[model samples]
Target: MKISPKKTSLRGLRIFCVAAKYRNYTLAAEELSVTASAVSHQVKTLEDELGLELLTRERRGLRLTEQGARLFRELEPAIANIDGIIAEVQSKTAASQLRVSVQPFFASECFVPVLEDFTARNPGIEIFVDTSDETAERHPVSADASIRLFRQKPTQLESDALFPLRLIAACSPDFLKRYRKGQEFTPLPILVHTSRPEAWNIWSKATGITLPPATSVVRLDSMIAVARAAERGVGAALVPVPLSDNWFKYGALVPMFDEIAELPETFYLAYPKAKAEIAEVKSLRKWVLDLFQE
Candidate 1:
């Protein structure tokens, strides 16, 4: 049977793409603001029209069939191009605005300090920043680019390495004074970043000190919170360099040891490869790369 243009609806293809990206009918439905059954029906209709088995159900979730994966890879870029064109047409002035998603720690430590310089250099360009954790977890971020910490470069997006994370053990001045009174320091308590529990292990390896389990452990989710806790004399925390630099300089926190551990993880500016050619994206990418180089 020959497929007609009317038979392959744009709406159906859009639905299928969302469904394939999420690999869950319910999630696709939620994103599309439709019912799960409606999403399923649309996908089934698309498969019938194309005569291709696009998806398979697994124990945990849906998986794309081989044919489905190939179609998705090709369709995704086409859709991105279409969306970009539509956006450009809809708002002629959009070229002046650059949307960026950034990791909170990086924004606070790195970007914010130099933001003024960027604004001054490109007086006509406006930057909007989003620091949601969700932005870092997904691809095709809802922005021009995302600055995030990653163990490895994400395969789905183009990325430029910003810098490697340098970590150091630090604590409140009072805590260090009590624990290190003219002798080798012993642990009073330890502050742990929930995202990086292996920090203690890494610090121990770097300093070659057999650190015993902490008498108390305070686990926090964000780097900001962990650093704040350490400054308040909660416990000694393994924190990233530059992010914790202000606290140390202000005498709110003191380095617990002289050794600094360099983590394998690095921060990168990532974006959809499809958007690499956009003038705004290219300009912002250059600014970020130059900032880090300095």
Candidate 2:
């Protein structure tokens, strides 16, 4: 079976190689963000083309069959060549303009609306994003700049404070009037992200308002999920000020109380120590800082 490049994806090859080397489909799946079955399918596809048994399955996990070890050793150079090509492409792209990584929800809610505005102002630079739930430790070091929400001096990166963070209690206003109409704001489901487990407690402490033991407390992994649940009247969510403004403006959710807590937290514009000197990166950093100035 001749494996044509068009017939198979590079992803299948990479996943197969990683699984064979590690002898763990689960580990390969974790790295690739897929199910174990998906990894198995890719590896099977590779094995079918090569006419070989890649692994012998065990109750614990995979153990390499004789053919698998030989295949793995031979494939290492192919993998390294692919990696070099990828790095070359990325480096060329990186040199041309700005590469920014931002927290996903914040990018959608806060940064996106004004994104074209930044582009308009800085016509010389192009922007790319590596958006995710949160910044990985090496994230700032990897990109020209990062838009992040947390309060810490990232090692080696220069940070310009964007805004002091504001977290507010919010829910669908009509939900309040309809579901819990006559009752005091006591019993209501509360949606909190895992990042801020004590949000309600902190807000209550700051405002000196004792909310009744919550009717429901659901933990979510993302602010977007928390905000969406609150929009659907599934629960109340503590949302950052930057996000709340857009949601309320669009009639998605309403601030439950006017009292906002200034989280000892802030979002910052951070860039790698080396990349900060690049013209495109510097322009974007200034553009972001000017938003706060206005």
Candidate 3:
């Protein structure tokens, strides 16, 4: 029987390929976001149009008939190639626009300084940086990628470790001088990042320096605020190294102790695993890994 081009449904053929590959209508339906009945109907329509039986349903699940297997063998590659071409086209279109979510601290201290370099290199890509702590922490679906601190590697997302977060106890020069006591800063108030309230405790334990009893804790929402508070002598704060390098260099803050508290958390550049190979994602991943990884 000759198949009529007008009568044949491309969707039906694609459904048949999926049904054949999985050998189960339900499975195919799940992948295609359709009902099993819909999958069955599409396959049946394809079989009628081709005048061939593509599948034989059995008690165990599903089985492909000889003709169905042959059709699948031929059509799968074609469908995959077509899918690839479509993805390529879409990727190129998306390559012009990129959205990245970043932690506020990283945005101000690290990313912004070097953003011009990336823009200069990829002039065609218009990148939007969202520096909201909420978006950076949750890694919302809208963002193409996120740069955030993670204690454990994110298993669900494709990620590259950028750098370990080493926090140092820091205070304003005046605070350090006032509190300095034979290599130990006297128990002054501890400026704490609200997200990591235990940061000072961790630093104290790591360095074997006991936090004084009745030490006041002033909680702030972000690392930048903590750094700024410490710089202004509000309290001695635990500040992430490298990100706070400029603060130390410019004499805004000085290290209270030589020891560093290397937290379990590390900064990571992360994106959906499925987007790993997309042109824009790939470019951003490479650029970020190269720029930040140590």
Q: List, in order, the clash count of every candidate structure.
A: 0, 0, 0
Model 3 scores a TM of 0.68
Tens digits of lDDT, candidate 3, 149-241? 877787657888899989888889998788888765566787778788788788888888775653687889987788888888999888888
Q: Residues 28-144, candidate 2, lDDT per residue (tens digit)?
A: 675466788999988888778777788888988898888888767787667756655655566567556677888878788867778999888887777887776364323433466
lDDT of model number 2: 0.74
Cα shift from native, residue 28, model 3 (Å): 26
Task: TM-score each candidate.
Answer: 0.81, 0.65, 0.68
Better of 1 and 3 by TM-score: 1
Off by more than 4 A, model 3:
1-90, 134-137
Model 2: residues with Cα > 4 Å off, grouped in runs:
1-95, 136-138, 179-183
Between which residue pairs do clashes occur in model 3?
none
Ranking by TM-score: 1, 3, 2
- As a TM-score, model 2 comes out at 0.65
lDDT per residue, candidate 1, 94-165, as tens digits?
Answer: 457888888787788778888899889888888898765522334433577888787888676789888788
